[model samples]
Target: MIVSRTALLETLSAVQDTVSQLIGDLNESEIKDIEDYLGRICRHLRCSRNALVSINKLPSEILGYIFQFIHADFASPSRSWIEVSYVCRHWRRVALSMPSLWSVVDLRQKGFDVHKLEAFVQRSKAAPLTVFYQNPPSDHLVLRALQDVVARNMYRVRHMHVKADVCPPFSDVILSEPAPSLCSLSLWHKGPAFPLLHANSARALFDGRAPLLRKMTISACALWYVYRITSLTHLALYNSEAHWFGDSFVDMLDGCQQLEMLFIVSPHLRLATEVEQQHSNRIVTLPRLHLFYIVRVVCKCYPLPWLRHLLAHLEIPEYCDFRVEFWMTDREVVPEGSILSIFPPPAQFHPLEQVATVKLLTTSTSKSCIAVHSKTLFIVAHGDAFPLGLPNDFLCPIARIVIVNNTETTSFLLWRTLLSTTTHLKTLDVFEKYLDTVEFIQLLCPDLGAEGVSPVRCPGLQTVNWACLSYPDVDLLFGLMAMANDRAHCGSPMRAISIWPSVNGEDKRTVEFDSLGAPMGYFTRESTDEDCPCLHVVEGLIAAATPKRPDEDGW
Candidate 1:
């Protein structure tokens, strides 16, 4: 007879109560027998409950596909696929039966479990593997065990990334057999700058063959071996040596005509000889190239000829986006009257000639950053080295729109130098937080008075939008009214002017119009609802909520 669920629970509870009373009266041996019998009953009940769950009815193939999304790696062994298998016997069977679910083995992680690695290889069957090895301990027995397992499956290995402070013994030795399935490889050496394997040894390291190799990333030492692989479509060279460029570099570029993306970073340079000059003079066109990026991390010294030489040689399509960036640190402050070096003349560099819009931004960190439109040329500089004056005549026709955000008085003064450079500037948007209101008004709309000598800096500027910190005082309000009156007399009235003051709370806007019924924008004040009765503490709260960086301002 089939029993109801409630009756089953009632009977089980009665049996449990009786067992509990008998356990107290029984001898140790008799209690052990009862415990074993009870264990079997609980296990059977759990299994029966699991069978009733709807998910247990899924086909093995569907269950296996779902298990692939479990995201297991050696980094966090507790969260690996082994955890999923522990839920039920049927789930464990399904997970174990799927080979693709155990393909990527990241052995670089701490807590190296040889059993799990062995299990992965066993369950993977014959699928190709993607492996990452970095910072593994030097346990000889453990290393030997891992090597043996990899040796048995080396032929099926495909994508591998090896980053280690010190080279592991098996790194080169594992490639003794040709990996027919291998396609992508990235090797990073974070240790001292020592020569990687010799050119011949390096070529032989990969058995002088990887017919299907399409992408490779190598640093200083092994770059000479790039020519051995002509089938490459994407290449990245990090921390490249001086000797790698000119002929060898260009030859590598020539060989990889199929390359679509190229990235070079933090490359040191040496003065180019006449032979290198001849190689650079020869134009190398990459028809398939779409994106090229070169970045130098910190610039203590100006102008790297090799980079200039590399840019001069490549003839990429107009549709392609080419970008170059040089970072200037606080340690390298610009010498007096030499700030123009930061903004090099367009003719000097072929890429900067096409810049359309320029943004000069000052952050609370006492640093400034410039971003130029051409889909390229982003300069990040720390400390105060403003790009002032017209660096060259090339920028004269290019820069039409300018935006400046200055948070300190020092940066505000530095920005005036940049404004003087662009003669044809149409729109100027200024955001300043630390400047005197009367002085700011005098600079924008100078009080000609009886002298009538100085003129507005940007004569072509038709529209102006300015924002600054505001108080309850009338100084800024009277200063803006005087500014509007001056602009009307000059016959080039501002198309629109918006003065925004960052007060304590929500924004309140009040607009006005001129005698001719022309609409003039208004200043924004903090909402009255946020008015704190405790006036003494308002400053502290405002300071606490203010962001200290440009990015922290949320755009």
Candidate 2:
């Protein structure tokens, strides 16, 4: 069924040309239909090409290569490659004949036919499989099919990700013959733990013999079950219900020497409780760790000292909602009267060379929050509130600062910090709402500064992006325009300033301007014959803000 190479190329060329033409004409419905057709044609072509060749004709090495290309992780089912078999007979044969490609079967979809499921399991040819069940099966037929597939491939499964939407039927298959090749396992329950699979049943899956197992994730399970994973490298436990105390959780960590990445998402356990006191033993060693993320539901005491012992680098997002405890390592904590302390001992030890970026994100439900700190010097604060104050000496050699969701006061403070203090600052981006404040405009052109000293002074300043500007906010626009004009008048000149207006109701085609005239630095705006100079000024600001790459240096 494979078409000639020439025919395939011709089809591809035609499809590309058709798509390009459709793009030129902005008819969305027609474009979508054409895209669908193109996808079908591409799938069909792949199927046809795969079917034409015999297995023996291709070398075993080449066959393995083909298998690698086809074998996919079923975790992402929405990908187009999943439909390889549906293209044509040739593709179906190639796909079916390749056992490695069929190995990982995801049964998360509801109402999956048992017969087809069984056939897929059989076709996988003993290669390791990962069965995912996201939704509950409506009938016993689908359940039976799943049981049969698991039973048959019990020895071949490398990973089993189960999200039990309904109570599992505890048949012989549940109790018998655990998967020997299961190297990774994840279980997620919708509500509470099902009583049928008791602690013993949960323990049966590990049974002490998965030496190859490196990763395990469990949700809403007893802490005792986690003790069985002695060889884990990556472990994640979410909402391990209230009954499972933190002592057992700490005890479980004692055995996992190889554990590297530990993620505890939404642990309902409290830190101040007696259970935490009972497990005061520290994890003294975890040399191989590079990354750790903890998202706690309830406020917990600073676990930083313990984490410092384990990891070299960490990424904790602002919304994690946990307070950190700072415990100094024996080597780091300074002793009184020590000669070495004269140079001002480092207060805290961070393995990284510098704190790169800090982002203050504002959420709808919560107050303005300090969210992220990357190793690169970029600060982006978005909120109606002022960012928490930092000491003048707290050095952050930043290159760019982006402020979004700002009220007038927040905007004023931000401008003060950037214009007066932050010497390394380069680019400043203020959204329209922030610039609307008259106070912010006054701060930008502060009168208290040395006579004739421009309030906005960033020697390294390159670009400014002012978005959503309007007629009401024209004063703020004039201030920036004045700065640009002054800079141009001086020997040293600023690179660019870009402005995007809040064009809502007024017709863009018929907009007019009075005799105030276009500013000196304003770029020419594109307009139908009736557009004004104000629009031209806005366009000029935009042109200045656009960044230029090194490759385009001359241009």
* Candidate with the greatest lDDT versus the true structure: 1
Overall lDDT per candidate, in order of appearance: 0.57, 0.50
Sliding window of 10 residues with minimal summed lDDT for model 1: 520-529
lDDT for each residue of candidate 1 in 278-332, tens digit (9 for 90 to 100): 4445667787888776666344443444555665666665446665555555534
Error of 2 at 367 (Å): 7.5
RMSD of 2: 19.6
lDDT of 2 by residue, 1-555 (tens): 989989978987997786677676768888787779878987877766665667635665664466566456757645344466665564556667777676767776543567657767878876778777665544556666677777666778788887764344533453345656878878776657532344453453445556677888878765344334567788887765533534455556567667777766665543333332332434324444443444543322322222222222222232222222111223222212211111111122232224433332222222122222244323333322223334433445656666444344434444455455555666666554543444334544434233554475655555565555464343355565556555455433455555555534242211111122223222332331334455554444544444446675523
Which regions of candidate 1 fall more than 4 Å away from where they truly are? Answer: 1-49, 72-78, 137-155, 165-171, 174-184, 195-197, 201-247, 254-279, 284-296, 315-332, 335-349, 366-384, 387-396, 412-555
lDDT of model 2, residue 95? 67
Could you give the C-alpha RMSD of every candidate to the true structure, in order shown?
A: 11.6, 19.6
Q: On a 0 to 1 TM-score scale, where does candidate 1 land against the true structure?
A: 0.63
TM-score of 2: 0.46
Q: Which residues of candidate 2, in runs, are more than 4 Å off?
A: 1-71, 76-94, 165-178, 193-197, 201-205, 223-226, 239-245, 268-279, 296-407, 411-555
